[model samples]
Target: MWRSLWRSIDRFSPQYFKYILNELRGIKVVERSNRELVIDILQSMVEIVTYGDKHDPIIFEYFMEYQVMAEFVRVLKISKNSRIEAPLLQYLSIMIQNIESDHAIYYCFSNGYINSIITHPFKFEGGDLASYYMSFLRAVSSKLNRDTLCLLVKVELVS
Candidate 1:
């Protein structure tokens, strides 16, 4: 079953990648408050990355190639509730923390990707969401440098 699924995908195909991302974004718009449905979709995303070899890097590579991380951020930006945002944040944290390529990491900071997420976690007042947000920040800071950290502080984006 996995072989068949992988076979049908063109590893370099932008269409397949975009189709999955569009479907994810569509779920937010169409199903709005369906938390179970949202979690299900998020779970499927995690499953995709976990279903293959333990060291398999195909999914993350695809994500960077298509710049799908931006799409994920877009979803998180518009997310209105913890129910939906929590899983997305968890997924984002994984994506942000394990970024293995310099180019991908560069794009993250260069494209204002870090800014979007760095500020997201503070928007909510709930503890469940804040903890994940804090974790995400911790993951990001581990990779942050002096200049980037200074810039963030200079802009008053972080305390």
Candidate 2:
């Protein structure tokens, strides 16, 4: 469905891509009877966020929107016991890096989004899962371009 939508969109209009991406991102949060389908959709959305064309500001803006942030956080929160956890974390980390590379402001916004999501009241049950998330954040923070990191940190601290 999403592939067909993407193919149908006029590539010249970034807004069309943004609309499709937002809808796919929302699927990650929907309660579905078929868990496999949900996982597949989430995986596809992550891949789009990570590797889709960087020339589109609408794509980047869609990612920065709160709905996409919520879906990403929900995935990180709920996928702890699944076999896909490691790969999902890796994909998320790459997505974070891609967003950061494209816009420094988004780096700070996403970091805050992650921080808020993880620090919620419920206890996360899996030690390995928690460690993977922490490691991803640490890796991203360490490897971020120095100037971008400075800007991210400043915005994160202030906001």
- Error of model 2, residue 119, in angstroms: 3.3
| Worst 10-residue lDDT window, candidate 1 | 47-56
Per-residue lDDT, model 2, residue 140, is: 62
Worst 10 residues of 2 by lDDT: 26-35
**Candidate 1 residue lDDT tens string, 23-135:** 77675442356766666656555545432213545655665566655766666665565456767778767755766555445555656676776776555664587888777
RMSD (Å) per prediction: 5.9, 6.1
For candidate 1, the per-residue lDDT at 35 reads: 63
**Which candidate leads the pack in TM-score?**
1
Q: Which parts of model 2 have CA positions greater than 4 angstroms off?
A: 1-33, 76-87, 100-111, 117-131, 143-159
Q: Give the Cα error of residue 64 in candidate 2, in Å.
A: 2.3
Query: Which pairs, if any, clash in model 1?
Result: none
* Stretches of model 1 off by over 4 angstroms after superposition: 1-18, 28-32, 43-62, 121-123, 146-159
Q: What do the candidate models score in CA lDDT, each in turn? A: 0.60, 0.55
